[model samples]
Target: MGWSWPANPALWPLARELVKATETRQAAKSPLPHERETVAEIRHKTEASNGDNVDRTSAYLTFFRKHPEVHWALLAHLVSRNAGWSMTDLRGELLPRLLPANVQQDYFSFLERGNWLIFHDAYPQLLLYEESVKRQTTLFHLLPELHVSVFMQAVWNHFWKTGDSKLLTVGLIMNEQHYLETHMMSDETYQTTVVKTLPFALQEVLRLNLILFPYRAEGQEDGALRLAGAPVFHFASLAERIELGKRLYSLLFTSLRLREGAIQWASDKPHTGSRKDFWPHLFHDLRETAPGKAHQKKLGGCQLLPGANRLYSPALRHVWKQVRHEAPKAADWYPATKGVMRQLLLSREQPASFCAEEAYCQALEKIERAVLAKGKLFGS
Candidate 1:
């Protein structure tokens, strides 16, 4: 069944109570020493897992396994895997040919910062939820002490009462994207150096903004993997990003084939921050050819073209060092209740098919052609 914002008038009073309670807690005196200790422990855990992409990815998966009702953890794990793939792609064979070293580094910083910031904000909330389950009570009022957004305090409270995983997932998707809009998307440095740059513009034009969820169907000979996901569009718009995330959630959970298959694949395969995680036939963590060597086509509509060398998609540890990020700037982007309701309503759209393997392959070909053209023109 398609999920929607609960229309029961009785629930409205509950939501109002949650908001008032959150505000009261926020206005309360400093946390006692015991509360301080708990906050510190969660912070330490969040930092430990947030050290790098692999650590963060595994943390999300582990949390999801333990608390499957928190659908956002699983979704975050899959998307975090994609973020790692993108980080490696910057240092991969094709992109180096297309982008200068400094430009590549800058792009990595941009992606890494977003990944880090989101984990910083979201992991504590997950841990708090775990604590709540353990204590058999809702402890989301402590969210403010952890620097979590007030938006989530209400949603978590609502989920505690209703066990509505879909609503909580949607709430999280909205919260994180809105969080990014404040911290990363609007920053002048990122705007001037990353988002507004030609390379960033080219990413959209080349259809490189894809988020793939891969799964191997049952009884497929040779364990052929299939990908299902929609490309992100109009990323500069917060609404578009929210919509894209909702679509991904729908695609991941609504289809039984995809949900079961993706879960199995994630279980069987540990992420190594390489495209090889999903399509080892095309991508390798090690270099397959000498630098500047002419290469044959490697893909044809998601299948390998005959005799093509596996493209170099290095693991994250090989290509990049772990980043030590400054604490994210504090701010809340929560909208009025009316705006929240509107977003929730909009999140209830029909599930759209994200089987775009052919399109993804086409994008890869475009990048390959561009690289070849550059080599020919510059004689590098």
Candidate 2:
């Protein structure tokens, strides 16, 4: 679909309603000033970086600052796009030199601290293994977290390793994961974006994910992350899969809510064409074209992911079948999933400025739109 604004005046009615709904909500709440301005700032960057020498960081932040969840979905898209060449270039040329001095120092510290919200550093061994797999014959692990990080880093590292794209990508994913995890699980009190550019920093890494690991390696084997002949794909049969999926799902929900809340805020904020006007139409378009939305009605109602036939893999298919059959015996899975998302919304940390909050909201909203379109729960 075209990213350009629709030229047809016919579509404006939907867009106008979006603006009204979004702005009306803000007017009632006494919206901040900075929040209103940043939307324009982001839009400017997004447009500027659309050319040949696309500022990977700018394009991603422009997209992510408005839609954080797209970080992953798009990362996957990019990974699968150019056979890892473009992403490799981005990692090599941009990541290391991208940030300002203080931002760089703070980013490194965030990872070192492992605060779980702003930074995530994978074991160097995992990186080594992933590289070996990409070039050699090592058994690729199916553990989603491990697989995701490796995919993100390998593509990033493939372009260049002069600095630390591996670590940077890990940190970026962890930041989003933590932000959502903390917000979802915490109460009404929590600090948002411990540091500025936190979301933008994370976006950079996500863009790299799309550059590499875009597709499931055709000949790649599965079931490596599983234990002995338990139920191949279902969480019920595999203890590790169940535990991980549970955590991953929870994290995704938190990320989703955080993102949605941000967008809601952005659409309402002042300046930069009405985000409110843009949202509903975007959602409408998404509902029809999003890769994820097609099966939402069916999938949303399913009790077990493994039981759903929508999964693309045989192993995954087997797992869902088991999960569906065993779900009656399982306790409530919604608490960790749904409850957390609600909690994150209720407990958002106040931003440093109105614009920061607005930016955060825009970033989150962008992700939400992508998720709605793609139907994936996890954020990049």
Candidate 3:
């Protein structure tokens, strides 16, 4: 991949200066009293909001409202909401029938760990940025104390100087995915137990890799909601994940209906880790049918089939206990400047407008058929 300077010619020099400053700061031994206090306060806030899916989701939205220039906050909020939905799905109606108990537990652990680790690494950075904006000075030097990647230190400094939101967003997308590359994706336990399993392969075949953004389209009635997002292919590849994040960011911000409608929906609806948050007619937080009963297909191209029963998509608190996470194994996965610069080029490409209704409906019907087939074969 060819790496190039940011579009603004001035940024090349600014990047060099920030990189040098970060290197110099990393050699320091201790912080001043006020700096120590600032670190403590930010750490406290990060922990307070890091409690669970609900807390983290709200924290991201709150931060985005306060500091809209940091585009990654809203992106994180929406993506984290999806993570919560995935967590609940392990214990929801269809997955329980398809996957055994032990497999479900492992899958939950896998999803939860990735969710926890990303927040752990990213939240402190957001707090530091907040503090920087208040004090009118860059505070990213303290990032080393919080164990954030050096890549972010430079990116934050550049953003503070230039106010380039797009570059900053892509920078975050690159940093966090690489952060997971070592801690979660490359780990022996998750690799053997989750990623390499037959069930994992089934995720691709069933179209579960789609990251959906629900919104009410223009000229549509208030009661109607629709889905728009690109399917994530080759998720195991770091390059692919970065591309997926950029494509999603583009889709969300570039389209008028998606941007306004999604913000309105998220603002009005509190996330409870249920599909019902967006499509209440198709999904319910409570079980409406007995377990092992054949589920009637409720979906017809993203709208419910007429008079169909709602699917049981349980809330996070109802299905799974709050998880206590072990500290992430320490490693800085930042590549050289040449490699990081290559990711910036992806932000320049405009992704075509995506509508996920067809893909999502197909996946739902496939799961419904699987659940019915398993019920008949085992007579459960």
Candidate 4:
């Protein structure tokens, strides 16, 4: 298992599905018109600035317009590969400079107004947190009548139009312990980028992870936000551990969907060549980048992460690593112990996606394949 996912009975299905995900591969897209020009401009600036130059605002727009999730991957790489850095970089460091002048203020306004989505567990109109998304496109019914940023609204509108609210799953946003009072990333850059990116479904997931970084910090004994116990962590004994397992699954699901989705979208968008063809290709950037020392420290001795985006990768992996994979001590780490992950497998009748729905289906089907392969629900 060197440099690979662990061998836990609970994780094999996820591991198997993940393998299948890469098997078909997240298909890439053709390059958009401005990519080559943008790359040349970026390279010229990087060279001129001694390799630390930023992409031009025009190039930024075209790049994101072609691959909105690419920035999420980049940000993930930075956080996971480097240590001590936080989401604050998105605002103080990245956005103001990365975005054009005309939209900066509007972008800031989205941050100020995004308190609606970040702080509330549920609006009166929205459905309470449920495991299933009901196969509906828009989470508009999931939101309250409030002033949100232009960027968040686009995601809202897309889900409204498409009804694929898996991107807006409730556990990420609705759990007060997890989200309410969470420091919303509120970065103006993301607001700007989200508007131009290819898939509108992913913005909420990116936003959720940006804010989630504070708690994920390994050594932040006194960080601004601390979820020593999150989601169902405070529940009574056995019940609490059972719930924690579910929360872990939610994190895994969101990250993989976005990762696999990026793979699918990457091929169609124009930017580079085949996996080995270009200097910096999608998977090269997404998967090939080694975990940074800082991230390794946070992961401690964990074998792998939960999703394509390293930042949003499972913190539970760190938790599992904390006890060094000892089965007897599982209850010491969390209220629930062995065989818990089997309880959280993606259901067969889960809601359908309006687009890239097959990615969700294909990924889940791997679990069925896992079941077939192992001859049991717990595919060890």
Model number with the top TM-score: 1
Candidate 4 off by > 4 Å: 1-91, 117-194, 197-380
Show where candidate 2 strays beyond 4 Å.
1-40, 43-162, 187-380
TM-scores of all predicted structures: 0.93, 0.18, 0.93, 0.20
Judged by lDDT against the true structure, how good is candidate 2?
A: 0.28
Tens-digit per-residue lDDT, 1-380, candidate 3 = 12345565645854575566556665866878999999998878887887788789988988988997888898898898888988888888778888999999999898888888888899999999988888888888888888887767878888887888888898899889988887899999999999889988888766777788888777787658888888878778889999899998988888877888887778878889998897777788999877767665666666667877788899998888888877876667764435566566555567887888788778877887787787789864
**Best candidate (score: lDDT):** 1
What are the C-alpha RMSDs, in order, of all predicted structures? Answer: 3.3, 27.0, 2.5, 25.3
In terms of TM-score, which candidate is stronger, 1 or 4?
1
Question: To one decimal, what is the Cα RMSD in angstroms of model 4 from the true structure?
Answer: 25.3
Comparison by lDDT, 2 against 3, better one = 3
Off by over 4 Å in 1: 1-14, 294-297, 335-338, 346-348
Instruction: Tell me the TM-score of model 2.
Output: 0.18
lDDT for position 333 in model 4:
16
After superposition, which runs of candidate 3 have C-alpha atoms over 4 Å from their true positions?
A: 1-11, 294-307, 335-338
Worst 10 residues of 2 by lDDT: 223-232
Rank the candidate models, highest TM-score first.
1, 3, 4, 2
